[model samples]
Target: MIRQIFLALTLAAATALPVAAERIGDAARGATLFDRQCKACHQIGDGATNRVGPTLSNIFGRKAGTVAGFKYSKSITRMGADGLTWTLQTLDAYIENPKALVSGTRMNYRGMADASARADLMAFLRDYSDQPANIPESEPTARKSEPTLDPAILAIQGDPEYGAYLSSECSTCHRRDGADEGIPAITQWPPEDFVVAMHAYKSKLRPHPVMQMMASRLSNDEIAALAAYFATLE
Candidate 1:
């Protein structure tokens, strides 16, 4: 029964992201930027080859991982195999901030926060000449009543639609499925639990440096919105 509920929630989260193309960036400019800024650390279309860093040919299709050859502080090989592929939005956030996207990753790109630049980068990346890729299976679930939302969290729940919009940022590491290996799918969490957990991260209680930084940056309203939206996952 519990597994059934989890699967339903995942299905609901999948539908929450209605895939759509964004036209806000210029691929030509992004390529130039990539050559000037990104070439030193990462190579394009090299297929798991890691020199100083992992190859980025099919980056959007990969889960968090370390390239086979390059030495990683942590062996993220398992993350890649777990099937939590990167999407355009996830790419954008990671571009904006790498360590924020994956807490323990070793890549040192501070990030390019310009919306147009990042968008253009993603566009360029999506078109890299290579094999077509596929995202793995999503979570499975059966029907169940919506989990009870915490009253305090309910008062601060932002627009469910907007919360849905913001959650794209979360999925970079959260994985589409809450149950993916090594990753905890927070979408199944109740709002109160979400809020409290985030609070723990925001404060010094949680020791993950990256999570703490990201959590500290989020406003209370943002946290509330995220909690509410994640709670509503199908």
Candidate 2:
């Protein structure tokens, strides 16, 4: 009876072990994975600066889109305004699928599909968090190349009148008053930023199904008009 009880207890402990390990993850392995998967855009550790993506040195408890000097997408900025702080669970969800969490995020990666891999990556990131004095002096990561836009398309002057007319379709999901409940707000965006983001969606680079479809149907002028209209919002 004693032996049998010991075996049962051991089995139970074994079952719990995987869950604990998954939560903690192997930070060393996560570092390697980060180099391959995230280093092209995101930087971390000591002396890390914003690259294509924001520097993620202390990202765990930080609010989204609060990184200074980086131009965040309206989606992420709205999320931050709506109280989206980065925690382990929230980061996990965002890493699993960015669009699912923030519909118009400009992160540009499809997402880490493997839960274990994401855990590892998160573990790597957590190392730098909450330790302002002791951050590791890691080398800066390479920046991802951005797609260049046509100068003419960017130079196109949009009519806010036309934009207001087209904005009805956009207002269905994005609130005109700039509230981001689930969907990100579109109001008060810079026209150039708005234009670039729409073009990204049209090219299918931004990776939201609804946005891709919506942008696919709009002409360049229409997108420019919408950008102009949304920028005027207070």
Each model's lDDT comes to 0.61, 0.76
Model 2 segments more than 4 A misplaced: 1-23, 131-234
Which 10-residue span in candidate 1 carries the lowest summed lDDT?
A: 138-147
List model 1 lDDT by residue over 1-234, tens digit each.
112222223323423332221143577888998888888988886453556877777565456664455665463455455654566555666678777756677777888867667767766776653333332332111112232234554467566677787788888888756666776788767777787667556643445666767777777678888888888785
Task: List candidate 1 stretches off by more than 4 Å.
Answer: 1-20, 46-49, 75-84, 129-234
Candidate 2: global Cα-lDDT? Answer: 0.76
Q: Candidate 2, 216: how far from true, in Å?
A: 58
Candidate 2 contains a number of clashing pairs equal to 0
RMSD of each: 15.7, 19.2
Who wins the lDDT comparison? 2
Error of 2 at 13 (Å): 5.3
Winning model by TM-score = 2
